[model samples]
Each structure stands twice: as structure tokens, then as C-alpha cells.
Target: MTLFVVSIILSAAMLHAVWNAIVKTAADRTTMLGLVALGHVIPGAAMVVLLPLPAPESMPYVLASTLIHFGYFYMLGRAYAHGDLSVVYPIARGIVPALVALWAMIFAGEVLPLQAWGGIALIALGIQLSSWQALRSGVESGVGRAALGYAVGTGFCISAYSLTDGLGVRLSGNTLSYWAWGAFLHLFVAGFIGLRKRNTLAALRPRTWIIGIGGGLVSMTAYGLVLYAKNFAPLGAVSALRETSVIFAALIGFVFLKEGNWIRRLGAAVLMAGGVALIGTSL
Candidate 1:
């Protein structure tokens, strides 16, 4: 990956972490998620009106991605319900790069070099390490096991959508158009959750509304950047780099939330940075 691509992905990773953190902390996760989806719809609707339609072939991928995101949101909410952000976030994101790489290899016929594979492995390891202690504790309990299951499910959803969007955006011929369409399709997600949570929506505090929608906008930008980067880099490389959101979340927790052991956070961050360096050099 070039410096430019790496920079874009890293920025996306940070923003990705931020939005996930917001969701993790929300009082009403489903309602908050619906608002986030609405956030995407607002901007997406405007852009769809202004931008040309994506290539006809790419519409199928866009539809497929939207369906996958429904599963992603559901699994994410379930995971957070069972485990702490430290535990849930790492496990959920840690598995994506390898899964995406495997899917890309099978479906897209994209085989990465050995060094790049090593980098992805290192990133996966570092992400898991970031939440090792919390994960271990969660595993020893029933709820933790439930969290583990849901988090793993979330990982699958993430990988599926990442590959879907990666291929979709590449074929779309216009990244912005593809992105806008994808965002606009999120209306389904918002509507589904909103209808289910209608009774609760009217009771939500103003703060919750603002934060949820704001996080949605941030999430949109983050994924938009990832889709843009996928156009230039291999899927596995981009996925691994993007999963650095785990590291960013850990750092955010340590610095701002005053959570976790410093030694562990620092160690995980170092490993992630080294992994990034390897991937950057491999290309």
C-alpha cells in the first residue's frame, strides 16, 4: 500500500472506532442505531439526487451489501449487550482481514504475497491482544460466551460487506456514486429498526438523538474512505489496515476513557504499527 492509501485507511479506522464507541456507550442501542442509519440516509438521499447512478451491474452488489449490513447491526448490538466494548470490538474486528482475504481469494481471484499475509496475521493478533484480559474474563462466563458468539457473527457480517462493497465500488466506475447509493440503501436498515423501536424513539433524550446521528455521519465518512481505498489496494490489505480501528479504540479508551492496562494497550499498538509497516513495505 502506498503512503496515501495507508493514511486514508488509518483515518477511516479512527473514525470507525469513534462511531462504534458511541454505539457501545449508547443508552438505547437499537434506537441509536436507527438514528445512525437515518444519518446516512439524509446525506445519501441528497447525494443520490445530485450524483449519477452507479453502473447497472453494481446495483446488485449494493443491494447485497445493504442486506449484509442489517446482519452486521443486529450482531453488533447483541455483542455489545453481552460484553464490554474492549472485548466485543476486538473479537468482532480481529477476524475481518483474514476472512476478507480468504473471500477475495476465492471470489475475486486475488492472491496476496506471503509478506502481506504475514502482515494481516500480525494485525489480527494485535487486535485480539488489545482486549486479551477482558476477553478472557468474558469467556469464563455464560454471558461472555454469548458475546463471543455474537461478536464472531458480527465479524462475518463485516467481512461479507467489506468484500461486497470492495467489489461493488470497483465495478461501479464511480466511487462517489457507488458510495451514495450504498448510503441511500441504508434507509432499509433505519426503517426496520425505527419501526421496531417506534415506541422508544419518541421518548429518547435530545442528546441521544444528536450523538446517534452524528456518529452515523462519522460512520458514513469512514466507510466511504475505505471504499475509496479499496479501489487502489488489495482487499486483504485494506481490510487489515481498516481493522486497526481496534487499536484506535484501545488507545481512545486508555487516553480518554481511562480504561485498561497501559502496558497492554502500548504493546498492542506497537504490534499493530509494525504490522502496518510490513504491509506498507510489502506493496
Candidate 2:
């Protein structure tokens, strides 16, 4: 990958970790989700208008992306209910690049040299090893136990969106438009579901608004950067690099949240670095 693309991926990784940390602290799911939607909705709407509309051929991919993202939001909510940012985010974000590699090979017809496969394995293994800490720590915190199942599910959902969005943007010939539309439609689904219930709409706290808007902006920026980086670099490389958000999330959890153990954090860091090294060897 080019230096520019790597830099973009790293920037996106940082933003992605930061916003996810914000989300994990949210107390009200409905309001938080809605406010997050609002944040994306503004940027998404603006981007949609700024860019040319997608070709009709790309609409199917866009719709599929929207559905997949709904699942992403739903599963994210469920995972947050069970775990901390350190545990759940790493597990969820860590799983997708490997799966995306397989998906790309089979469905997208993207090829990886043998070294790439080995690198992917290290990425997967690092994610798995990091998760062991969560399994043990979660029991005591009671925060991460339920997140195990939900976080796993969220991983699949994220892969769906990642691959689908990658394909859609590549096909549409407009990555910006594809991502903006996906973001808007995604927020639409989350917003509708949140508003459907009884009193969920009545209560909206200031923190929710602040965090949600900030998260939405950061999240949208991160996705935009990812889409751009994917276009310029190999999909697997982009995905693998992006998953380093787990490392960032772990650090944020430790420094800001002060809930993480040093040993587990170190392990997570080493595994993530190993994954990056393995990925670099392939290149």
C-alpha cells in the first residue's frame, strides 16, 4: 500500500476507536442511537447532495448495505449492553478483516498471495487471544459476559457492511456517494426503530446529544476515509489496518475509562502489532 493510503487508514482507525469509546459509555440506548443517527444524517445528507447520484446498477448494493448496517447498529447496541469498549469493540472489529478476505476471494474474486493468508491468520489469532482476556475479565465486571455473544454477531454484521460497501463503491465509481448514502440510510433505519417504541422519544439528555453528534461526525469521517483508502489500496490491507482500531480502543479504555488491566492491554497491543507485521510481509 502507498504511504498516503496507510496514513488515511490509520486516521480512520483512530476516529473509529474514539467514537466507539463514546458509544460504549452511553446510558440510554434508544436516545444514543437516535442522536448518533442524527449526527450521520446531517453529514450523509450533505454528502449525498454534493456528489452525483449513483448509477442505477449500484442501487441494489446500496440497499443491501443499508440492511446490513441496520444489523450493525442493532448488534452494536446489544453488545454495549454486555461489555466495555475495551472488550466488545476489539472482538467485533478484530474479526471482520479475515472474514472479509475470504469473502473477497470467493465473491469479489480478489486474490491474496500465500503470505497474505498467513497475515490474515495472525490477525484472526490476535483477535482471538485478545478476547480471552475479555472472557476472564468480563465475569467480574459483568459487563463483558453478555457482550461475548452480541459482539460475535456484530462482527458478522460489520463484515457484511464492509464487503458490500466496498463492492458498491467500486462498482458505483463514486466511493464518496456510496458511503454517504449508506450512512444516511443506515441512520434512517436506526432512527425509525428507535422512534417506534413508547416513551423512548420523550427523553433526550444533553450528553447523548453531544456524544451522539460527535460520534456521528467521527464515524462518518472514519468510514469515508476507509472507503477512500480501500479504493487506493488492497481491500485486505485496508481492512486489516483498520482493525488496529482495537488497539486504539484498548488504549482509550485504559487511559480515559481506567477500566482495563495492563497485561491484557499489552497482549492486545502485541497481537495487533503482529497482525500488522504479518500484513506488511504479504505486501
Candidate 3:
């Protein structure tokens, strides 16, 4: 990747970590998630009117991506409910790059070079390392097992949408239009979650709205950048670079969520940075 692309992807990574932290801290994750989806719709509804419709060729990918994202949000909410942010975030985000790379090669015909593969492995290893101490700290087997299962499911959903949007944006001919449409589609996810949490919505306070909506905007911008970068770089490489967000999430968990074992996490961050460097140099 060029410096410009790398910078955009890194910024996206930070924003993504921040939003996940916001969700991780919420008392009612499903309700908070619905509000976040509403945040996307609020802005997206306006943009859809202003922006031109995406190409017909891109609509299928957009619809596919939207459906996958619904599953992503559902699984993510469940994962957070069952595990710590540090543990859940790493496993969920860590596995996506490799999966995206594999799918991109198999389905998208995007072949990565050797160094890029090395970088992906290093980043994946670092991500797993970041969560090692916590996973080994003797949490209950039942909760731990459930969290792992949910986290892995969330990872698969992420990879599904990552590839879907990456190709969708490319086919759309206009990144902004594609992004707006994708955001607008979030209404379906919001409505689904909202119906499930209908009894809880009226009770949500202003603070919850602010956090959820604000985080949603950030989340939208972060993924928007990723979609844009996908237009210029290999999907797998871009996805691997984006996994650096795991480092940010670990720090966020340590500082804000009062999660412990900073030394190991910091070490993991270094490995992630090294992996990023390898990928950047290869580009």
C-alpha cells in the first residue's frame, strides 16, 4: 500500500477500536447496537437522497453485504455479552484478515505475494498473543467456551461482509454512492434489533443515544475508509492491515475497561506493528 492508503486504513483502525470500546462498555449491548444502527440510518437517509443510485451491477453485492452485516451485528452483540472486550475483540478481529485473503484469492482472484502472506501470519499471531494472557487467566470454562464460539462466528461474518463490500464498491463506480447505500441499508439491522428490544427502547436515556449514534458515525467512517482503500489495494492486504485495530482495542480495554496485563498486550502491539511494516514494505 502507498503511504496515503496505509494512513487511511490506520485511521480507520483507530476509529473502529473506539466504537467497539463504546459498545463493550454499554450495559445493554443489543439496545446500544440498535441505536448505533439508527445512527447510520439517520445520516444515510439524507445522503441517499443527495447521492445517485449505485450501478445495478453493484446492487447484488450491496444486498449481500447488508444481509451479512445483520448476522455480523447479531453475533457481535452475543459475543460481547459473553466475554471481555479484550478477549472477544481480538479473536473476532484477528481471524478476519486471513479469511478475507483466502476468500479473495479463491473467489475474487486477488493473489497476494509471499511477503504479504508473511505479514498476514505475523498479524494473526500477534492478535492471538494479545488475548493469550486473558484467556489463560482461568475464567470459567463454560463462559470461555461460549465466548470463543461466538467470537469465531463473529469473525466469519466480518470476513463475509469485508469481501462483499470490497467487491461491491469496486463495481459501483462511485465509492460515495455505494457507501451511502450501504449505510442506508443498516436500517434493516436496526429494525431487527429494535423489535427484539422494543420494550427497552423507551427507557434509553439521552446519554445512550449520544454514545450509540456517535459511535455509529465513527463506525461508518472507519468502514468507509476501508471500502475506499479496497479500491486501490488488494482486499486481503487491506484487511490484514486493518486488523491492527486489535492493538488499539487491547489498549482501550486496558485503560478504559480496567482490563489488566499491559505488558503482554504491549508486546503484542509491537508484533502487530512489525507485521504492518512488513506489509507496507512489500507494497
Tell me, by TM-score, which candidate is best: 1
Taking all chains together, each candidate's TM-score versus the true structure is 0.96, 0.87, 0.94
Question: For model 2, how does the per-residue alpha-carbon lDDT over 1-283 read when each residue is reduced to its tens digit?
Answer: 5667777888898998888777767776556657667788888888888889877687799999888877887888788777765567667877888878878888888888877667666766665565567755776766644688889899999888888877877887787788788777766765686667437655666766677888878888998899887776667777888888777876887788885576866786787777676666566
Kindly indicate the candidate among 1 and 3 with the higher TM-score. 1
User: TM-score of the candidate numbered 3?
Assistant: 0.94
For model 1, how does the per-residue alpha-carbon lDDT over 70-183 read when each residue is reduced to its tens digit? 889889988878886667878888999999999999999999999999989999999988888888877776554688899999999999999999999999999999999999
Ranked candidates (lDDT, high to low) = 1, 3, 2
List RMSD in Å for every model shown: 1.3, 2.8, 1.7
lDDT of each: 0.90, 0.76, 0.88
Superior candidate under lDDT, 2 versus 3: 3
Clashes of each: 0, 1, 0
- In what order do the candidates fall by TM-score, top score first? 1, 3, 2
For residues 3-26, could you state the per-residue lDDT of candidate 3 as single tens digits?
899999999999998987888788
- Candidate with the greatest lDDT versus the true structure: 1
